[model samples]
Target: MIIKKTSLVTETKDNMRGGNGAPVITHVIGGEILGNKGRLYSKIVMQPGDSIGYHQHVGEQEIYYFLSGEGMVKDNEETIKIYPGDVMITPDHGYHSIENTGTEELVFMALILNADA
Candidate 1:
């Protein structure tokens, strides 16, 4: 099945996952569609200074693929700069967070999958 861009669900979140500022989240697919395979599949847009706070994944793993702009990611205790084409993975029980540090909007795709799947 194909999903239309106009039909995609979008929302702005404040202090998402404990981060700062509001970030736009466009769902590429809903949880129901993902079933037990995962919990999230979306495109995230963060303006300069916006962030997604540090958090840990218990039974799941998350992946982030940067599309544009620049950002910084705190992967466990290591802080790394992110740019277009960059990809980050947080394994189960791992901690990670991200912040938009560029002048333009930071765009990326995020996917979270159940560890058991």
Candidate 2:
């Protein structure tokens, strides 16, 4: 089965996960699609000045693949520059956050899955 782009659901949230500005979330799959399981597959768009707050993952892990634009990714206490084609992984028991520091929008694909599943 193929999921068309137009068929995908997109939602904009202000201060997502206690973040800074509103970010657009394009849900590709997961959640109810996974029977309320621990999984997330989505595209995230963060405009200038937008950000996702720092948070820790205990029972899960997340991977972020930058598709376009630039940003600063805060991994624990370190802030690293990120660009297109870059991939970052925050393992279980780790913390991470992202900020759009460029003039253009920061676009990325995020995949989250249960650590033990």
Best by TM-score: 1
lDDT of each: 0.96, 0.91
lDDT at 26 for candidate 2? 94
The collision pairs in model 2 are none
Per-residue lDDT for 1-117 in model 2, tens only? 788999998999899778899999999988666554457899999999999999999888889999999999999889999999999999889999999999999999998877775
Compare the candidates by lDDT and give the number of the best one.
1
Off by over 4 Å in 1: none
- lDDT agreement of model 2 with the native: 0.91
Residue 46 C-alpha lDDT in model 2 = 100
Candidate 1 pairs with clashing backbones = none
TM-score of each: 0.96, 0.92
Report the C-alpha displacement of residue 72, candidate 2, in angstroms: 0.4
- How displaced is residue 31 in candidate 2, in Å? 3.4
